[model samples]
Target chain A: MLLVILELVGIAVFAASGALAAVRARLDVFGVTVLALATALGGGVIRDVLLGVHPPTSLTKWPYLLVPALTGLLVFSFHPQVARLRRAVQLLDAIGLGLFVTGGTSTALALGAPPYTACLIGMTTGIGGGAMRDVLLREIPLVLRREIYAVAALLGCLVVAGGSVLGLPEGPVALAGSALVVAVRLLALWRRWNAPVAHGLDA
Target chain B: MLLVILELVGIAVFAASGALAAVRARLDVFGVTVLALATALGGGVIRDVLLGVHPPTSLTKWPYLLVPALTGLLVFSFHPQVARLRRAVQLLDAIGLGLFVTGGTSTALALGAPPYTACLIGMTTGIGGGAMRDVLLREIPLVLRREIYAVAALLGCLVVAGGSVLGLPEGPVALAGSALVVAVRLLALWRRWNAPVAHGLDA
Candidate 1:
């Protein structure tokens, strides 16, 4: 029950990012809604698909679909106000990243994937929605280019996976893992830390 | 049996496009290979996932992974020569588009998806790889921006779906659908046909 609430909150934050992007692109309402849905659900959908869950929860569950759809419309109408709240959204986004990575890792673990694969899948689930949104908006994925996003997700996923391997309690471990991700992500953003580019590529 | 052969050929063609794009982007050998694999296998993997097939054939089957990896290496080594063969690649790409849509539709139908959902899946399967490639390359997908790509795929998918509805034989209908996609794609290229953009968004 708590996890579901976290997931919904994460979806709404992710959807806001997507909706704002679409608005900046001046997309029509339909396009904004579509992009919002894709950004909010793409990661979970990808994770579920990898786990062989048919008609993924995002597709079948009403709340999973509804939150993003409604959020998109709200953002579309009040984009200026929403844009002014960027800092708040970013904080929420960090929390969402933590939730998604930990949630995704444990879900994959429970669904029978090995630890390594679960870690990879969990990382993908944490990053996939933003990647899809960037693709739709015609930008190279920020995660692939500059952000510490995937690494942060991986760290959290590893914590979750390690807990399972050591037969530790899942709940405490998950909370710890989520905290690790949130801390790492917020620190990275505050410090403006970024991954390095390949050396001498254009030199 | 023939379908498998056709699928392999289609994957190779799609991989080539991805490799060429990666080469143009001046990505490293590993990056080129990664993009090729994503482009070649993304659609089928997505289809399989939606159908509840765990460890999608793209992941489980060595040959499926091998073809694109090898193709990427080959292109990376001889990109100039490969670039000169653009026309040939375009022709093969049309064929690939045909095979993917028809095959994707039938596979979904066989997997018990309703026809409407199957048609959407099939069209997605046909266009998904190219869309992914463009995203990785940091460009608007040609299919979304200027090409008649998705419509061509949809036409083929609808034929497959309609054939099933009308009680026509699968094999012949699939053949006809593939031919239709190929013909439409080639013709659109020759004629410089394009879909209209939304009116006066920035005008």
Candidate 2:
């Protein structure tokens, strides 16, 4: 129950972010909706596909579709007010990041991925949606360029994978892992810490 | 036997296009390799994933991995001369588009996707790699803006799907579909034909 809720929240936040980005880019209503759907659902779809799950929830379920679709439309309709709440959105995004990474890791484990591969897939799940949104917007992916986003997800995934490997119960370990990711992401944002750029050739 | 050969040729051409784009973007060798791999293998990976196939051929098969990796390196090493072969590459790309669309549709059909769904997936498979490359390169997806790329793929897929629905043989249907895609793509290029631009709002 809790996991389902968390997933919905994550999808809604991601959808809002994508819708806002489309608005910022001066996209039309259709564009906003498409970008939002891609941003909210792209990661999970990729993860499910990798795990060999057919007709992923993103494609088949009602709540999963409705939440993101509503969020995107709402964001599009009230973009000015939504944009003003940037800090709040960032905080929600941090929370979303936490939930998605932990959820992704657990799901990969459930699907019988090797621990290390699960860790990688978890990170991919966390970043995939935003990457799609950015790409469609004709921007270099923020995950590849932004501050500590993927690193935070990777670290969280590692913790989950490690716990799973050690025979720890999944529920508590996932909660702890998500908390850690949220903490690290928030702290990074608060401190303005970023991984060092890889010299002039990184681009 | 013939299908395997055609698939390899398509992958090589897509890889070369990606690597050439990377070079044109002034990306480093690593970036060139990554882009090339994504372009060559991305579509198939997506198609396989949607079909609930695990550890997609791109991840597990040696030939699938090697051809694109080598293509990227070779292109990076001899970009200037290769870039000069633009016309030849375009012709190859048209052939690749044909193969991918036909292959994708067939695979989807085999996996039990509905005829229309298979058609859409086929078009997706034909364009997904180039979309990834263009996105990574921070350019608008060429398929979304340029000549009749997606349209040609869609039309080809429709032929394949229509044939299947009519209980036609798969082999000849696919061959005919692929030929149609290639012909349309090449004719569009040769005749300087393009879809009319949406006024102002397409961006």
Candidate 3:
């Protein structure tokens, strides 16, 4: 039940981000909805596909589709109000990132993927949606450029995978992993920490 | 045997297009190679995943990885010369588009997907890689913009799916479908045909 709630919250936050991106790009209503759906579900879909699950749960489940669609509609109707709370939204997004990373890692581990692949898939699950959103908006993905985004997810995945490898209990390990992600992400935001940019012509 | 050759040719053409896009974006060698790999195998990987195939063949198979990598390297070293033959590249790309559309649709049908779903998947397989390449380069996908790109793929898919619905022989139907796509795509290029763009507010 708690996991379900976490996933829903994560979907809502990601959907909000996607809607904001569409608004910023001045996209039409159809585009806004498409972006919202992609941002909220794209990562999970990608992960599921990588794991060989056909007809991704997101596609088959009604709530997964409804939540993002409604979120997009709400944002479209009151974007000005939403835009003013950008900081709050980013914080929520960070929380969502934490939840998604843990969920993804646990799921991959349960599916018997190698620790390394699990870690990578976990990180991808956290960042893939936003990357898809940016791509649709014709912009460089923020995760790939600025902030300690992908790195934070990676660290979270590493912790979770390491704990699992050590035979730690799943619940506690997942909690610890999520906490790590949230802490690192909030700290990076507060401190304006960024990943290093590639330097020189060969990078 | 024929299918293998067709797939290889498609990969090479798509990889070339990806390398050219990376070059146009002023990306370094790493970006070029990444784009090449994404464009060459992304669509098939996506299709496989949708069909519940785990660890996509492209990811596991050595040749799939090697062919695109080599193509990327070649393009990176001689992009200027390749760019000069833009017309030839487009011709090859059109052929690749046809082959991929037919292959994807047939594969989906064989997997027992609904005809509509098969058609959609086929179009996705034909266009998905290019779309990903454009997105990575921070550009609107060419398939989504100018030219009859997606439409050509859709038409090809329709023919393939339609034949299956009519209980026709797979080989002849697939061949005819591919021929239709190639003809339409090349005609569109020669005639400078384009899909209509929204002419209103906030496109």
Instruction: Tell me, by DockQ, which candidate is best.
Output: 1
lDDT of 1 at A163: 100
Comparing candidate 2 with candidate 3, which one achieves the higher lDDT? 2
- Which clashing pairs does model 3 show? none
Taking the candidates one at a time, how many backbone clashes does each contain?
0, 0, 0
Query: For model 3, how does the per-residue alpha-carbon lDDT over B1-203 read when each residue is reduced to its tens digit?
Result: 88888888889899999988777766656557667878999898888877766766665556776788899878888887788898999898998899989999999999999999999999889998998887787777888786788888989999999999999999899989988998998999999998666687675
Show where candidate 1 strays beyond 4 Å. A201-203, B1-44, B50-52, B57-131, B138-203
DockQ of 1: 0.19
Give the lowest summed-lDDT range of ten residues in model 1 chain A.
A194-203
Please state every model's RMSD to the true fold in angstroms.
6.8, 6.7, 6.8
DockQ of each: 0.19, 0.16, 0.17
Chain B TM-score of all predictions, in order? 0.96, 0.95, 0.94
Instruction: Name the better of 1 and 2 by DockQ.
Output: 1
Give the candidate number with the greatest TM-score.
Answer: 1
TM-score of chain A in every predicted structure? 0.96, 0.95, 0.95
Residue-by-residue lDDT tens digits, candidate 1, B1-203: 98888999999999999988876776656567667878998899878876777756665566787888899778777777787898899899999999999999999999889899999999888888988888788887888875688889999999999999999999999999999999999999899998887798997
